[model samples]
Target: MSKDAFAAAALALTAAAENGSNMCLSFLNALPVTHAAISTLGAPFGSETICASDSQAARLEELQIDFGAGPCWDALRTRAPVVDADLSEPTESAWSLLREAIRDTGILSLYSFPLAIGELNVGALDLYATTRAALNLPLIARASALADLAATPVARQVIRRLPHLDTDDTNPATYSRREVHQATGMIIAQMRVNADDAQALLRAHAFTLGRPVREVAADVVARRIKFTRDDVVDRD
Candidate 1:
């Protein structure tokens, strides 16, 4: 990173700290990426979009949710950076569906950097490029540094919002999808399971119904869907 780029990144991150992760997407403009997104790993919802540079960036992030496989997913799952500078190349065999989706969108490169603090994996920073070219070592280092700087703020926001969600008289849409967290706690109470398994069950039920996790969480919160020991039964 050059001196000017480094200064700009610092200023952008300062702005993000003041507002939220929504302000962080603009930070990627200093890089070669055309579009970008920040996704946080949620308990019941798998990965939820935190912010994006634009609608196109948001849609690129959603490809993982729609198709269930992508570089972002891999990075979060394995706690490693997924660097694919050329999606059109035949070298990628892990996520064929995601590659085709990117190709269809006219994006030629994709990158994912996991946000981890020690053993805890929080989320991922995803980037897209319009041209087909590999990223050099310096560029990769800059990307990694930016991802590291942004991760803590994102993680802190999630933690700060948890208490608010657990209390009474809180809005559901205050911090993105708050119902998802409430529904996760409800599932924990109903099933007497750990957060991980409860969230997995929640996601499985959503997948079975072919609906988004937030929509299913709304049903759960409304007392419309109940999870029994052996089945997810509808109360309606």
Candidate 2:
């Protein structure tokens, strides 16, 4: 892609940061693919399509979510891009079911990029072409960059929907305090997520409750809150 295309993508994604509905369209405008989709997979957000450039793109994401497997799932699991430049060839073992499911869909190529920030596994960005095509190194790199940019706002959009809880507020400066670090460690142990993901969970919980992140960290440190893979437990 040309520099102008990347610049356009940046602008479109910036707008998408505010209005998430435009995210897939933004990717479509920037890439060489025929369709695009943005989806959140598992935890905190659950697996669902956030947006798709067209019905075919939406169906592709829905199939992955239904079968619990696809390039998108692989992209997130490996935290790397998944590219199948020619769908006509034999499917990889990991994608057998998804390949069979999509065989009649007229898709000739597929690409997926993981959307992540720190330890938070937000979701994926998927692109597909109806006609045979390959994404060269530069295009893949640009797609990865766009996916990275999309992760934060996508996470925030999901976090904002949680029910707000009443809590004491603290200074934003306390976000970097020792207690915050300790609390993040506790969450890591509790949730089995990475340090970055643990901290993101803490910050997201604080945002949902309309409190300073430090206050939430303090609660975790005090054992007033406990995180589990399935839920956040209040020990109050």
Stretches of candidate 2 off by over 4 Å are 165-202, 205-214, 217-236
lDDT tens per residue, model 1, 193-224? 66754565566566545666777788898899
Q: In every candidate, how many clashes are there?
A: 0, 0
Residue 101 Cα positional deviation in candidate 2, in Å, after optimal superposition? 2.1
RMSD of each: 11.5, 7.9
TM-score per candidate, in order?
Answer: 0.64, 0.73
* lDDT of every model, 2 decimals: 0.71, 0.80
The numbered model that scores best in TM-score is: 2
Q: Write the per-residue lDDT of candidate 2 for residues 1-236, one digit (tens) a residue.
A: 89898988988887877765578888888888888998999875688898889998899889988988889988998999998888888855776868867767988888999987655577999998876665788999998998877876677667667654323335545445788889989988997766765766787777645677777888899899888754555667
Model 1 TM:
0.64
Name every residue pair that clashes in candidate 1.
none
